[model samples]
Target: MSTYIRQIKKNVWKWKNENGIFSVKKYPTVEQAEKIRLIHKELEYMEKPFILPIIESTQEDFIIQPWYKGDHTVSYRFKEDRKAVHLLLSQIHDTNKLVDWEDSNLFYSFNLISKWQNRKWKMNEISFFIESHIGWEQTKFLLLCGDIALRNMKPFNMEKRTLLHGDVVHHNFLSDSSDYKIIDFDLAVIGPREMENILWMHRVLPEINYDIRLLIHEFPHLEKVVRRYKEAMMYPNELYREWLYAYSLPKERKQKFIEQLIPYTNKALTEWPNLCYTLSKL
Candidate 1:
Protein backbone atom coordinates (compact mmCIF):
# COMPACT_ATOMS: atom_id res chain seq x y z
CA MET A 1 0.00 0.00 0.00
CA SER A 2 3.00 2.32 0.47
CA THR A 3 5.34 3.54 -2.29
CA TYR A 4 8.45 5.14 -0.86
CA ILE A 5 10.57 7.96 -2.24
CA ARG A 6 14.22 7.58 -1.32
CA GLN A 7 16.33 10.67 -0.59
CA ILE A 8 13.38 12.66 0.62
CA LYS A 9 13.63 16.43 0.87
CA LYS A 10 13.91 18.69 3.98
CA ASN A 11 10.89 18.11 6.20
CA VAL A 12 8.59 15.99 4.02
CA TRP A 13 9.00 12.49 2.61
CA LYS A 14 6.61 11.67 -0.25
CA TRP A 15 5.25 8.32 -1.35
CA LYS A 16 2.32 6.57 -3.01
CA ASN A 17 0.10 4.16 -1.15
CA GLU A 18 -2.87 2.01 -2.20
CA ASN A 19 -4.86 4.92 -0.85
CA GLY A 20 -2.97 7.74 -2.62
CA ILE A 21 -0.07 10.25 -2.28
CA PHE A 22 1.49 10.40 1.18
CA SER A 23 4.33 12.18 3.00
CA VAL A 24 6.40 11.75 6.15
CA LYS A 25 7.67 14.73 8.12
CA LYS A 26 10.42 14.45 10.71
CA TYR A 27 9.72 16.89 13.52
CA PRO A 28 12.60 17.86 15.78
CA THR A 29 10.97 15.99 18.65
CA VAL A 30 7.69 14.51 19.85
CA GLU A 31 6.85 17.68 21.78
CA GLN A 32 7.20 19.69 18.58
CA ALA A 33 4.88 17.33 16.76
CA GLU A 34 2.26 17.53 19.46
CA LYS A 35 2.42 21.31 19.54
CA ILE A 36 1.92 21.49 15.78
CA ARG A 37 -0.93 18.99 15.79
CA LEU A 38 -2.74 20.82 18.57
CA ILE A 39 -2.39 24.01 16.62
CA HIS A 40 -3.72 22.33 13.48
CA LYS A 41 -6.73 20.95 15.32
CA GLU A 42 -7.64 24.47 16.32
CA LEU A 43 -7.16 25.57 12.73
CA GLU A 44 -9.57 22.85 11.63
CA TYR A 45 -12.10 24.11 14.11
CA MET A 46 -11.72 27.63 12.81
CA GLU A 47 -12.08 26.60 9.19
CA LYS A 48 -14.01 23.65 7.80
CA PRO A 49 -13.26 20.16 9.01
CA PHE A 50 -9.80 20.55 7.58
CA ILE A 51 -8.71 17.11 6.45
CA LEU A 52 -4.97 17.45 6.16
CA PRO A 53 -2.55 14.62 5.42
CA ILE A 54 -2.81 12.44 8.53
CA ILE A 55 0.04 11.89 10.94
CA GLU A 56 1.24 8.31 11.51
CA SER A 57 3.69 6.89 13.98
CA THR A 58 6.07 5.18 11.60
CA GLN A 59 8.97 3.08 12.80
CA GLU A 60 11.23 6.09 12.32
CA ASP A 61 9.26 9.33 11.72
CA PHE A 62 5.85 11.07 11.42
CA ILE A 63 4.08 10.58 8.09
CA ILE A 64 1.58 12.75 6.15
CA GLN A 65 0.56 14.08 2.73
CA PRO A 66 -1.79 16.80 1.44
CA TRP A 67 -3.68 14.13 -0.52
CA TYR A 68 -2.36 14.95 -3.98
CA LYS A 69 -4.52 14.63 -7.05
CA GLY A 70 -1.90 13.13 -9.36
CA ASP A 71 1.89 13.43 -9.41
CA HIS A 72 3.30 16.31 -11.46
CA THR A 73 5.68 19.32 -11.40
CA VAL A 74 7.02 21.47 -14.23
CA SER A 75 9.71 24.16 -14.86
CA TYR A 76 8.31 25.99 -17.85
CA ARG A 77 6.61 29.41 -17.65
CA PHE A 78 2.97 29.87 -18.45
CA LYS A 79 2.29 31.82 -21.63
CA GLU A 80 1.06 34.69 -19.48
CA ASP A 81 0.92 35.51 -15.76
CA ARG A 82 -1.28 38.55 -16.22
CA LYS A 83 -3.85 36.65 -18.18
CA ALA A 84 -3.90 33.82 -15.69
CA VAL A 85 -4.23 36.12 -12.70
CA HIS A 86 -6.98 38.12 -14.32
CA LEU A 87 -8.97 35.14 -15.51
CA LEU A 88 -8.74 33.38 -12.15
CA LEU A 89 -9.60 36.40 -10.01
CA SER A 90 -12.52 37.43 -12.16
CA GLN A 91 -14.02 34.00 -11.85
CA ILE A 92 -13.45 33.75 -8.08
CA HIS A 93 -14.63 37.28 -7.22
CA ASP A 94 -17.87 36.71 -9.05
CA THR A 95 -18.28 33.47 -7.19
CA ASN A 96 -17.37 34.84 -3.72
CA LYS A 97 -19.77 37.76 -4.05
CA LEU A 98 -22.58 35.23 -4.00
CA VAL A 99 -21.55 33.64 -0.70
CA ASP A 100 -21.75 35.33 2.70
CA TRP A 101 -19.50 33.64 5.24
CA GLU A 102 -21.01 34.78 8.60
CA ASP A 103 -24.36 33.42 7.51
CA SER A 104 -22.81 30.27 6.07
CA ASN A 105 -20.71 29.34 9.14
CA LEU A 106 -23.65 30.12 11.48
CA PHE A 107 -24.86 26.58 10.89
CA TYR A 108 -21.87 25.18 12.85
CA SER A 109 -22.03 25.82 16.58
CA PHE A 110 -18.84 26.70 18.49
CA ASN A 111 -19.28 24.06 21.23
CA LEU A 112 -19.12 21.03 18.92
CA ILE A 113 -15.89 22.42 17.42
CA SER A 114 -12.43 21.70 18.82
CA LYS A 115 -10.83 24.36 21.01
CA TRP A 116 -7.21 25.08 21.98
CA GLN A 117 -6.23 23.29 25.17
CA ASN A 118 -3.42 21.27 26.81
CA ARG A 119 -1.22 24.36 27.29
CA LYS A 120 -1.66 26.41 30.40
CA TRP A 121 -2.03 30.15 30.02
CA LYS A 122 -0.68 30.61 33.55
CA MET A 123 2.50 32.63 34.12
CA ASN A 124 4.52 29.40 34.31
CA GLU A 125 3.27 27.85 31.02
CA ILE A 126 3.23 30.73 28.58
CA SER A 127 5.10 30.34 25.28
CA PHE A 128 4.80 32.32 22.09
CA PHE A 129 4.64 31.71 18.34
CA ILE A 130 6.18 35.15 17.94
CA GLU A 131 7.97 37.61 20.19
CA SER A 132 4.66 39.43 20.38
CA HIS A 133 2.68 36.32 21.42
CA ILE A 134 0.98 34.83 18.37
CA GLY A 135 0.10 31.15 18.66
CA TRP A 136 1.29 28.79 15.96
CA GLU A 137 -2.16 27.51 15.05
CA GLN A 138 -3.67 30.94 15.21
CA THR A 139 -1.06 32.81 13.25
CA LYS A 140 -1.59 33.58 9.58
CA PHE A 141 -3.41 30.28 9.07
CA LEU A 142 -5.08 30.99 5.79
CA LEU A 143 -8.22 28.95 5.10
CA LEU A 144 -6.54 28.29 1.78
CA CYS A 145 -3.00 28.86 0.48
CA GLY A 146 -3.01 32.65 0.83
CA ASP A 147 0.63 32.64 -0.04
CA ILE A 148 0.53 32.97 -3.81
CA ALA A 149 4.20 32.12 -4.06
CA LEU A 150 3.42 28.50 -4.84
CA ARG A 151 0.27 27.21 -6.47
CA ASN A 152 -1.43 24.16 -7.80
CA MET A 153 -4.84 25.71 -8.11
CA LYS A 154 -7.12 22.79 -8.74
CA PRO A 155 -10.09 24.87 -7.64
CA PHE A 156 -12.19 23.39 -4.86
CA ASN A 157 -14.49 25.02 -2.31
CA MET A 158 -14.77 23.63 1.21
CA GLU A 159 -18.44 24.33 1.91
CA LYS A 160 -19.60 23.82 -1.65
CA ARG A 161 -17.47 20.69 -2.04
CA THR A 162 -16.38 21.80 -5.49
CA LEU A 163 -12.76 21.29 -6.46
CA LEU A 164 -10.99 23.54 -8.91
CA HIS A 165 -7.54 25.07 -8.67
CA GLY A 166 -8.00 26.77 -5.27
CA ASP A 167 -4.86 28.72 -5.74
CA VAL A 168 -4.13 30.82 -8.82
CA VAL A 169 -0.43 31.48 -8.35
CA HIS A 170 1.49 31.71 -11.61
CA HIS A 171 3.45 28.52 -11.15
CA ASN A 172 0.51 26.50 -9.80
CA PHE A 173 -0.55 26.20 -13.42
CA LEU A 174 1.26 24.10 -16.04
CA SER A 175 0.52 23.90 -19.74
CA ASP A 176 1.82 21.00 -21.77
CA SER A 177 1.64 23.09 -24.97
CA SER A 178 -2.15 23.55 -24.85
CA ASP A 179 -3.62 21.84 -21.79
CA TYR A 180 -3.16 23.13 -18.23
CA LYS A 181 -3.44 21.46 -14.84
CA ILE A 182 -2.84 22.39 -11.20
CA ILE A 183 -0.23 20.69 -8.98
CA ASP A 184 -0.47 21.58 -5.27
CA PHE A 185 -3.31 21.19 -2.75
CA ASP A 186 -1.34 21.60 0.47
CA LEU A 187 -3.70 24.35 1.67
CA ALA A 188 -7.06 22.89 0.69
CA VAL A 189 -9.78 22.74 3.36
CA ILE A 190 -13.53 22.21 3.56
CA GLY A 191 -15.45 25.22 4.90
CA PRO A 192 -16.82 28.59 3.96
CA ARG A 193 -14.54 31.23 2.38
CA GLU A 194 -13.54 33.02 5.60
CA MET A 195 -12.48 29.96 7.57
CA GLU A 196 -11.47 27.83 4.59
CA ASN A 197 -9.30 30.46 2.91
CA ILE A 198 -8.10 34.01 3.22
CA LEU A 199 -8.94 34.62 -0.40
CA TRP A 200 -7.63 38.12 -1.16
CA MET A 201 -7.56 40.55 -4.04
CA HIS A 202 -4.24 42.21 -3.15
CA ARG A 203 -2.11 39.17 -2.34
CA VAL A 204 1.64 39.23 -2.48
CA LEU A 205 3.02 36.88 -5.09
CA PRO A 206 6.40 35.52 -3.97
CA GLU A 207 8.30 37.18 -6.74
CA ILE A 208 11.57 38.88 -5.86
CA ASN A 209 14.21 40.84 -7.77
CA TYR A 210 14.38 44.02 -9.81
CA ASP A 211 12.93 42.42 -12.94
CA ILE A 212 9.71 41.45 -11.20
CA ARG A 213 9.78 44.71 -9.34
CA LEU A 214 9.96 46.45 -12.72
CA LEU A 215 7.22 44.28 -14.17
CA ILE A 216 4.94 45.08 -11.24
CA HIS A 217 5.77 48.74 -11.72
CA GLU A 218 5.11 48.89 -15.45
CA PHE A 219 1.97 46.84 -15.26
CA PRO A 220 0.43 48.15 -12.07
CA HIS A 221 -3.08 47.02 -12.95
CA LEU A 222 -1.78 43.48 -13.05
CA GLU A 223 -1.48 43.69 -9.29
CA LYS A 224 -5.27 43.33 -9.25
CA VAL A 225 -4.78 39.59 -9.39
CA VAL A 226 -2.86 39.81 -6.15
CA ARG A 227 -5.54 42.09 -4.72
CA ARG A 228 -8.31 39.72 -5.68
CA TYR A 229 -7.17 37.23 -3.08
CA LYS A 230 -6.51 39.87 -0.43
CA GLU A 231 -10.15 40.82 -0.59
CA ALA A 232 -11.35 37.52 0.85
CA MET A 233 -8.87 37.21 3.78
CA MET A 234 -10.84 36.78 6.99
CA TYR A 235 -8.38 37.05 9.87
CA PRO A 236 -9.55 39.20 12.76
CA ASN A 237 -7.01 41.62 14.22
CA GLU A 238 -6.58 39.67 17.47
CA LEU A 239 -6.14 36.31 15.74
CA TYR A 240 -3.82 37.90 13.25
CA ARG A 241 -1.59 39.15 16.03
CA GLU A 242 -1.84 35.87 17.93
CA TRP A 243 -0.93 33.76 14.91
CA LEU A 244 2.14 35.89 14.18
CA TYR A 245 3.38 35.56 17.75
CA ALA A 246 2.72 31.83 17.75
CA TYR A 247 4.90 31.11 14.73
CA SER A 248 7.55 33.75 15.28
CA LEU A 249 10.80 32.00 16.01
CA PRO A 250 13.83 33.28 17.91
CA LYS A 251 15.29 36.71 17.28
CA GLU A 252 17.65 35.48 14.57
CA ARG A 253 14.85 33.84 12.63
CA LYS A 254 12.61 36.86 12.98
CA GLN A 255 15.45 39.02 11.72
CA LYS A 256 15.86 36.79 8.72
CA PHE A 257 12.13 36.87 8.00
CA ILE A 258 11.99 40.63 8.28
CA GLU A 259 14.92 40.89 5.93
CA GLN A 260 13.13 38.74 3.38
CA LEU A 261 9.79 40.47 3.79
CA ILE A 262 10.53 44.20 3.76
CA PRO A 263 11.71 44.34 0.19
CA TYR A 264 8.64 42.49 -1.00
CA THR A 265 6.53 44.99 0.86
CA ASN A 266 8.42 47.89 -0.61
CA LYS A 267 8.01 46.59 -4.14
CA ALA A 268 4.34 45.88 -3.63
CA LEU A 269 3.72 49.33 -2.22
CA THR A 270 5.39 50.80 -5.27
CA GLU A 271 2.99 49.29 -7.79
CA TRP A 272 -0.03 48.99 -5.56
CA PRO A 273 0.06 52.72 -4.74
CA ASN A 274 -2.12 52.11 -1.67
CA LEU A 275 -0.77 48.97 0.00
CA CYS A 276 -1.60 48.52 3.67
CA TYR A 277 1.06 47.61 6.20
CA THR A 278 0.03 44.33 7.76
CA LEU A 279 3.20 44.02 9.80
CA SER A 280 4.18 47.58 10.42
CA LYS A 281 4.31 47.44 14.23
CA LEU A 282 6.19 44.17 14.23
Candidate 2:
Protein backbone atom coordinates (compact mmCIF):
# COMPACT_ATOMS: atom_id res chain seq x y z
CA MET A 1 0.00 0.00 0.00
CA SER A 2 1.13 3.60 -0.59
CA THR A 3 2.01 5.46 2.56
CA TYR A 4 0.80 9.05 2.71
CA ILE A 5 3.65 11.52 3.10
CA ARG A 6 2.36 15.07 2.99
CA GLN A 7 -0.07 17.26 1.15
CA ILE A 8 1.70 19.49 -1.34
CA LYS A 9 -1.25 21.80 -1.58
CA LYS A 10 -5.03 21.58 -1.75
CA ASN A 11 -5.21 18.67 -4.15
CA VAL A 12 -1.64 17.41 -4.41
CA TRP A 13 -0.09 14.75 -2.20
CA LYS A 14 3.16 12.88 -1.70
CA TRP A 15 3.18 9.10 -1.33
CA LYS A 16 5.73 6.36 -0.80
CA ASN A 17 5.69 2.64 -1.59
CA GLU A 18 8.08 -0.26 -2.25
CA ASN A 19 8.72 1.28 -5.65
CA GLY A 20 9.94 4.50 -3.95
CA ILE A 21 8.39 7.97 -3.48
CA PHE A 22 6.27 9.88 -5.96
CA SER A 23 4.00 12.92 -6.13
CA VAL A 24 0.34 12.58 -7.06
CA LYS A 25 -1.25 15.80 -8.24
CA LYS A 26 -4.97 15.81 -8.67
CA TYR A 27 -7.52 17.90 -10.60
CA PRO A 28 -5.41 18.93 -13.59
CA THR A 29 -7.38 19.08 -16.82
CA VAL A 30 -6.12 17.11 -19.85
CA GLU A 31 -5.06 20.41 -21.45
CA GLN A 32 -3.10 21.38 -18.37
CA ALA A 33 -1.36 18.03 -18.38
CA GLU A 34 -0.54 18.48 -22.07
CA LYS A 35 1.01 21.87 -21.39
CA ILE A 36 3.13 20.49 -18.57
CA ARG A 37 4.22 17.61 -20.79
CA LEU A 38 5.25 20.08 -23.50
CA ILE A 39 7.21 22.20 -21.05
CA HIS A 40 8.98 19.14 -19.65
CA LYS A 41 9.78 18.02 -23.19
CA GLU A 42 11.37 21.36 -24.00
CA LEU A 43 13.46 21.34 -20.85
CA GLU A 44 14.53 17.79 -21.53
CA TYR A 45 15.63 18.77 -25.03
CA MET A 46 17.83 21.53 -23.61
CA GLU A 47 19.66 18.94 -21.42
CA LYS A 48 20.62 21.52 -18.82
CA PRO A 49 22.58 20.49 -15.72
CA PHE A 50 19.49 20.32 -13.56
CA ILE A 51 16.70 17.82 -12.90
CA LEU A 52 12.98 18.17 -13.48
CA PRO A 53 10.52 15.48 -12.48
CA ILE A 54 10.03 12.67 -14.98
CA ILE A 55 6.31 12.09 -15.33
CA GLU A 56 5.84 8.41 -14.53
CA SER A 57 2.21 8.31 -15.52
CA THR A 58 -0.95 10.37 -15.98
CA GLN A 59 -4.62 9.60 -15.61
CA GLU A 60 -7.71 11.58 -16.55
CA ASP A 61 -7.40 13.80 -13.45
CA PHE A 62 -4.05 12.98 -11.87
CA ILE A 63 -0.37 13.13 -12.82
CA ILE A 64 2.53 11.38 -11.09
CA GLN A 65 6.28 11.93 -11.06
CA PRO A 66 8.88 9.95 -9.14
CA TRP A 67 9.92 11.86 -6.03
CA TYR A 68 13.31 13.54 -6.14
CA LYS A 69 15.15 12.89 -2.91
CA GLY A 70 16.37 16.14 -1.43
CA ASP A 71 15.50 19.04 0.79
CA HIS A 72 14.36 22.43 -0.46
CA THR A 73 17.11 24.98 -1.07
CA VAL A 74 16.19 26.83 2.10
CA SER A 75 17.66 23.98 4.10
CA TYR A 76 20.94 24.11 2.17
CA ARG A 77 23.74 26.66 2.11
CA PHE A 78 22.26 29.88 0.78
CA LYS A 79 25.27 31.22 -1.12
CA GLU A 80 25.87 28.04 -3.10
CA ASP A 81 22.20 27.46 -3.71
CA ARG A 82 21.74 31.05 -4.86
CA LYS A 83 24.58 30.78 -7.33
CA ALA A 84 23.30 27.52 -8.72
CA VAL A 85 19.77 28.81 -9.02
CA HIS A 86 20.94 31.91 -10.86
CA LEU A 87 23.03 29.87 -13.26
CA LEU A 88 20.18 27.46 -13.91
CA LEU A 89 17.82 30.37 -14.55
CA SER A 90 20.29 31.82 -17.07
CA GLN A 91 20.47 28.50 -18.85
CA ILE A 92 16.69 28.22 -18.94
CA HIS A 93 16.38 31.67 -20.44
CA ASP A 94 19.18 31.04 -22.92
CA THR A 95 17.46 27.93 -24.24
CA ASN A 96 13.98 29.45 -24.43
CA LYS A 97 12.04 28.93 -27.67
CA LEU A 98 8.63 30.23 -28.50
CA VAL A 99 5.97 27.79 -27.30
CA ASP A 100 2.92 27.13 -29.42
CA TRP A 101 0.45 27.71 -26.60
CA GLU A 102 -2.40 27.73 -29.10
CA ASP A 103 -5.91 27.77 -27.55
CA SER A 104 -5.00 26.35 -24.12
CA ASN A 105 -3.71 29.68 -22.76
CA LEU A 106 -1.74 27.52 -20.32
CA PHE A 107 1.29 29.74 -20.63
CA TYR A 108 0.34 33.33 -21.31
CA SER A 109 2.68 36.26 -21.83
CA PHE A 110 3.44 38.19 -18.66
CA ASN A 111 2.41 41.84 -18.59
CA LEU A 112 4.62 43.39 -15.91
CA ILE A 113 3.21 46.90 -15.86
CA SER A 114 -0.42 45.86 -16.01
CA LYS A 115 0.07 43.35 -13.16
CA TRP A 116 1.90 45.93 -11.04
CA GLN A 117 -0.82 48.50 -11.69
CA ASN A 118 -3.46 46.04 -10.58
CA ARG A 119 -1.45 45.27 -7.45
CA LYS A 120 -1.14 48.98 -6.76
CA TRP A 121 -4.89 49.37 -7.04
CA LYS A 122 -5.50 46.41 -4.71
CA MET A 123 -3.05 47.86 -2.19
CA ASN A 124 -4.91 51.17 -2.30
CA GLU A 125 -8.26 49.50 -1.76
CA ILE A 126 -6.92 47.80 1.36
CA SER A 127 -4.71 50.67 2.53
CA PHE A 128 -7.13 51.82 5.19
CA PHE A 129 -7.34 48.37 6.73
CA ILE A 130 -3.60 47.90 6.57
CA GLU A 131 -2.95 51.32 8.01
CA SER A 132 -5.30 50.59 10.87
CA HIS A 133 -3.22 47.53 11.68
CA ILE A 134 0.33 48.74 10.99
CA GLY A 135 0.00 52.47 11.65
CA TRP A 136 -0.02 55.26 9.08
CA GLU A 137 3.73 55.82 8.65
CA GLN A 138 4.52 52.20 7.82
CA THR A 139 1.59 51.84 5.44
CA LYS A 140 2.49 55.11 3.73
CA PHE A 141 6.07 54.00 3.22
CA LEU A 142 4.99 50.78 1.45
CA LEU A 143 2.58 52.67 -0.78
CA LEU A 144 5.29 55.19 -1.68
CA CYS A 145 7.65 52.41 -2.59
CA GLY A 146 4.97 50.80 -4.77
CA ASP A 147 4.40 54.07 -6.61
CA ILE A 148 8.11 54.55 -7.26
CA ALA A 149 8.55 50.94 -8.41
CA LEU A 150 5.73 51.37 -10.91
CA ARG A 151 7.17 54.68 -12.14
CA ASN A 152 10.59 53.16 -12.83
CA MET A 153 9.38 49.92 -14.40
CA LYS A 154 9.23 49.72 -18.19
CA PRO A 155 6.36 48.30 -20.18
CA PHE A 156 6.64 44.63 -21.13
CA ASN A 157 8.53 44.01 -24.38
CA MET A 158 6.93 41.21 -26.32
CA GLU A 159 10.06 40.65 -28.40
CA LYS A 160 12.21 39.71 -25.38
CA ARG A 161 9.89 37.03 -24.07
CA THR A 162 11.09 33.74 -22.63
CA LEU A 163 9.68 30.87 -20.63
CA LEU A 164 9.79 32.06 -16.99
CA HIS A 165 9.60 29.68 -14.05
CA GLY A 166 7.27 32.33 -12.55
CA ASP A 167 7.57 31.40 -8.86
CA VAL A 168 11.18 31.54 -7.63
CA VAL A 169 10.74 31.10 -3.90
CA HIS A 170 13.47 29.00 -2.33
CA HIS A 171 10.93 26.34 -1.42
CA ASN A 172 10.41 25.59 -5.10
CA PHE A 173 14.07 24.58 -5.42
CA LEU A 174 15.12 21.06 -4.47
CA SER A 175 18.70 20.61 -3.30
CA ASP A 176 19.26 17.17 -4.83
CA SER A 177 22.61 15.79 -3.64
CA SER A 178 25.01 18.23 -5.38
CA ASP A 179 22.65 20.00 -7.79
CA TYR A 180 19.55 22.17 -7.45
CA LYS A 181 16.39 21.46 -9.41
CA ILE A 182 13.35 23.70 -9.82
CA ILE A 183 9.82 22.35 -9.33
CA ASP A 184 6.19 23.42 -9.23
CA PHE A 185 5.44 25.02 -12.57
CA ASP A 186 1.92 25.97 -11.55
CA LEU A 187 2.76 29.62 -12.08
CA ALA A 188 4.94 29.22 -15.16
CA VAL A 189 4.43 31.77 -17.92
CA ILE A 190 6.09 33.48 -20.86
CA GLY A 191 7.71 36.69 -19.67
CA PRO A 192 10.76 38.88 -19.73
CA ARG A 193 13.74 37.31 -17.99
CA GLU A 194 14.03 40.40 -15.86
CA MET A 195 10.60 39.70 -14.39
CA GLU A 196 11.84 36.38 -13.02
CA ASN A 197 15.07 37.96 -11.79
CA ILE A 198 13.16 40.70 -10.04
CA LEU A 199 10.96 38.19 -8.23
CA TRP A 200 14.02 36.18 -7.24
CA MET A 201 15.56 39.32 -5.79
CA HIS A 202 12.40 40.09 -3.85
CA ARG A 203 12.55 36.62 -2.31
CA VAL A 204 16.26 36.66 -1.45
CA LEU A 205 17.12 40.25 -0.45
CA PRO A 206 15.59 39.87 2.98
CA GLU A 207 18.02 37.07 3.79
CA ILE A 208 20.95 39.41 3.08
CA ASN A 209 19.52 42.29 5.09
CA TYR A 210 18.63 44.09 1.85
CA ASP A 211 22.22 44.89 0.84
CA ILE A 212 22.10 45.76 -2.87
CA ARG A 213 25.87 46.10 -3.24
CA LEU A 214 26.52 42.62 -1.90
CA LEU A 215 23.73 41.25 -4.06
CA ILE A 216 25.26 42.72 -7.23
CA HIS A 217 28.71 41.65 -6.16
CA GLU A 218 27.49 38.08 -5.80
CA PHE A 219 25.88 38.17 -9.25
CA PRO A 220 27.81 40.56 -11.49
CA HIS A 221 25.39 39.94 -14.37
CA LEU A 222 22.68 41.72 -12.34
CA GLU A 223 24.59 45.00 -12.19
CA LYS A 224 23.27 46.36 -15.47
CA VAL A 225 19.69 45.46 -14.64
CA VAL A 226 19.98 46.93 -11.16
CA ARG A 227 21.34 50.15 -12.52
CA ARG A 228 18.67 50.39 -15.20
CA TYR A 229 15.68 49.62 -12.97
CA LYS A 230 16.87 51.13 -9.71
CA GLU A 231 13.51 51.82 -8.16
CA ALA A 232 12.24 48.33 -8.85
CA MET A 233 15.04 47.01 -6.65
CA MET A 234 14.29 49.60 -4.02
CA TYR A 235 10.60 48.79 -3.87
CA PRO A 236 9.39 46.82 -0.85
CA ASN A 237 7.51 44.31 -2.96
CA GLU A 238 7.84 41.41 -0.54
CA LEU A 239 6.67 43.41 2.44
CA TYR A 240 3.69 44.74 0.53
CA ARG A 241 2.83 41.32 -0.85
CA GLU A 242 2.98 39.76 2.62
CA TRP A 243 0.81 42.48 4.11
CA LEU A 244 -1.77 42.02 1.37
CA TYR A 245 -1.73 38.28 1.92
CA ALA A 246 -2.02 38.66 5.67
CA TYR A 247 -5.14 40.71 5.09
CA SER A 248 -6.76 37.68 3.49
CA LEU A 249 -6.18 35.29 6.36
CA PRO A 250 -8.44 34.61 9.32
CA LYS A 251 -8.14 36.88 12.36
CA GLU A 252 -5.84 34.67 14.42
CA ARG A 253 -3.52 33.85 11.55
CA LYS A 254 -3.56 37.45 10.34
CA GLN A 255 -2.65 38.67 13.80
CA LYS A 256 0.20 36.16 14.00
CA PHE A 257 1.55 37.29 10.63
CA ILE A 258 1.22 40.94 11.60
CA GLU A 259 3.23 40.31 14.74
CA GLN A 260 5.96 38.67 12.70
CA LEU A 261 5.68 41.31 9.98
CA ILE A 262 6.06 44.37 12.21
CA PRO A 263 9.82 44.01 12.60
CA TYR A 264 10.31 43.28 8.89
CA THR A 265 8.12 46.21 7.93
CA ASN A 266 10.04 48.51 10.27
CA LYS A 267 13.35 47.28 8.88
CA ALA A 268 12.21 48.01 5.34
CA LEU A 269 11.03 51.47 6.35
CA THR A 270 14.40 52.23 7.92
CA GLU A 271 16.51 50.93 5.03
CA TRP A 272 14.43 51.99 2.01
CA PRO A 273 15.75 55.54 1.77
CA ASN A 274 19.36 54.37 2.00
CA LEU A 275 18.61 51.69 -0.61
CA CYS A 276 17.14 54.32 -2.92
CA TYR A 277 20.27 56.45 -2.53
CA THR A 278 22.51 53.47 -3.22
CA LEU A 279 20.54 52.55 -6.32
CA SER A 280 20.68 56.17 -7.50
CA LYS A 281 24.46 56.13 -7.37
CA LEU A 282 24.66 52.76 -9.16
Winner by lDDT: 2
lDDT of 2 at 19: 79
For residues 77-165, write the lDDT of model 1, one tens digit per residue. 32254444444334433333443323433223221012111111221133332323323442223212223212322222334432222
Give the TM-score (vs. native) of candidate 1: 0.34
Per-prediction backbone clash count: 43, 0
Tell me the lDDT of model 1 at 182: 39
Query: Which parts of model 1 are misplaced by more than 4 Å?
Result: 1-4, 7-11, 14-79, 82-171, 174-178, 190-200, 204-247, 250-253, 270-282
lDDT of 2 at 206: 81
Candidate 1 Cα lDDT to native: 0.37
- Clashing residue pairs in candidate 2 (N, C-alpha, C atoms within 3 angstroms): none
Candidates in order have lDDT scores of 0.37, 0.76
Candidate closest to the true structure, highest TM-score: 2
